[model samples]
Target: MTAIIHDAVIVTGDDEDTVHYGASIAIDGTRIAAIGPNAELQQRYPSAERIDGRGRMVMPGFANTHTHLTMTLARGVFEDLSPPHKPPFSGGLSPIPLPDMTQDERRVMAQLGALECLRSGVTFMLEDSSDIDDYAETLAGSGLRFLFGERAYDRTGTAIGDPAPFQLDRAMGEKHMATIERTFAKWNGKADGRIRIAISAWAPDMCSPELLKDLSALQSKLGTWITIHLNQIWGEVAAVQAHRNRLPTEYLADLGFLNDKVICAHCRCMDPREEKLLGDAKVIVAFNAAIAARRGLSPRIDSLERQGCTITMGSDNMAEDMVEVMRTGLFMERVRREDGRNPTPEQALRWASRNGYKAFGMADGGWLAAGNKADLIVIDTQRAHLVPMLRAVSNFVHNGQARDVQSVMVDGRWLMRDGKVLTMDEPAIVAQAQEVANKAWSRQFKKRFDKPPAGFSPAALP
Candidate 1:
């Protein structure tokens, strides 16, 4: 598969933040073969398929460091339901529980999430869940790169943020281990190295010390990556403190689970000492900025980066819009710093693209280079909101919408072209997923609420 997109603006999200105008990128097989002026690329690749790029800006696609793909089912319901940050913590992120779905239903919802990711120009994802195999095959067929982390934990009788007494569930932990191993065997290094696998510790409050140590050992033994939810909420922090008499980061540190290969998601509610501890470990922080804003929290991205942490961006739960994540991270950091010019758009794009791709162990991706992987997106820059494009990178970063994404390519294959999805049936996926979510919510509300509350109207379910 050889192709050339000629006469486009290229935003190479490299360390130098180079932007090339009137340039062309030549893709050969699964790698970028050449980048040069339009005539030069045309002359070089004479037999390649040509794509007009006069009104588009081509850049690296996003690599989301952390997200739960099936959480797309809770989109309209969960964003408005956040747990209290004070004492007497709630069990999980929301007081209202989500309706459970069958494996097939979950597969549909995961497809919906994948649709959103492709539409929003996400090429890579790290899915954190206890059971990824349920929808693993379905997502693999989507042609996007992924790093799957199958979770294992020992504590029972409580959800993520509950302060209940820890009950060791050794059998359940072993069950998770078996599933993790099975999933790894089935999918790790699959798709010709387009997909990778990882070991996941659910959370410090949810996993016992023995289980954490075991997970760490397994990660080392397998020579794989590790990921965890670290200090996501104050309730989880309180729960960890009560359970171990130490902060969540301290617990992981004591168990020797903190390392450079570990991708820590949501360090929003950590103490300054704990933050410093994570930075000292040189961990990568998946700064899920949009979800943090929904919960009215934010991570200390600057301080963490300064203290030696590699900062990356994630869409997290209930969303898959990396454009929103990148822009929101920029706005949040600017407001936090009270200085608008500190972390530039280039830096934010690096966190969203380059840093995340590096964290996913794809150093050859998320940037524009002659020999790098051909993973990139084309944005339609002829829209009204994108005009006056003196600063192309800043214009796209600050004001770009997901709808601006016109084409997406991963491994030199087009997953989306000119607003049409190529991998999955978008209409069928969306229709089935809408029914799945509607029925799930209807069932939950019917189970919990006897009558509709004021200002609440349930959807008419099939």
Candidate 2:
């Protein structure tokens, strides 16, 4: 089947990167066939089905390099927990006692999160899964392209409410490995080669050195990608330095785990030496700006980028809004550099889109060009913030929101059209997810506390 998107502003992913004023994109099967002026493409593919892209800007959808799909329930649930806002895993008081949610609850929440990603112009994601078996069905049904990172941990007594203690044991670790292998066999190259599995290790503190080494070896054996959080907080930095007598990056590098296939999230505390190590190892650094800002941590984006390090963007905690991430990224860098013009919108877009694909060892998607994957999003140009657009891409990075996204296509299929999802029933998914999360949070909070805090009424959630 052939389809041509006509009379649109095409942002071709080229080094010169000139926007085609009235171009058309022809898709043959799942790959882009041609990108040129509308007249040229129309004459080229005369009989193809046409999509009128008038009054719209078509660009490659953003790649969310790191995300916890099931963490959607935690959104806005723990905002004011403590001073500096203690995370659920921390020993400090938690705003809401995150209850033990079942696999079914996670699936419902994950489905809602997936739909949110599509609506926000995110076509690809590197999603971390707790139990691959439980959510495999939900992931399979999600039309969005993603990489499932099977998470593992072996250390115990590290933090409060940590899942690592429950996941410890060499036998249990091997069982998790078996699940990953089975998942890869069944899902890798499935859904028309849009989904693949990666081996994920929890942070160094949560996982022992032996577990990290074993997981690294397993990743190599399976030819899969590896992901881990590195230097997310000062406390983690202190612990790693105290235990290993080196920085977090140095410890990971010493394990022979630093490589191009490895993605290290939140290198906010990395210095020049560690930055160079990451650059030399060709490691992909996920700069999760939204979460970093919320936690009062920020990465040195320009410094790392200039040092030959490749950086990508991730929403991290379920702030699934890409525009928020981009804006936060721009502001974070500007604030750090004390130079408002240091990181431009173009650079921010590159991190959010192209760099994310490069991080995952996929080169075909993340840009609008011939022969790339047909994963692109369309933004309505008529919105108030989008009006008077002298520069289209800049306006998109700076002013556009998720609601501005009109349609989205992944693997030549419309996952969302006219702001409505086609593959999943979004309203039903959201309702079920809200119900389960509310019940879970309420029960957990009640059990953890004798009396609720002042002004905290046990009201029903939306």
C-alpha RMSD by candidate, in order: 1.5, 3.1
lDDT of 1 at 111: 90
Which model scores highest in TM-score? Answer: 1
**What are the per-residue Cα lDDT tens digits for candidate 1 across 333-384?**
9999998897899999999999988877789999999999999999999999
Per-residue CA lDDT of model 2 for 287-358, tens digit only, reads: 899888877778888877876778999987666888789888998999999997868888888889988987
lDDT scores of the candidates, listed in order? 0.89, 0.78
Error of 1 at 213 (Å): 0.1
Clashing pairs in 2: none
**Clash count, one per candidate:** 0, 0
lDDT of 2 at 439: 80
Over 4 Å off, model 1:
450-457, 460-462
Task: Give the clash total for candidate 2.
Answer: 0
Candidate 2 Cα deviation (angstroms), residue 231? 0.2
User: How far off is model 1, as Cα RMSD?
Assistant: 1.5
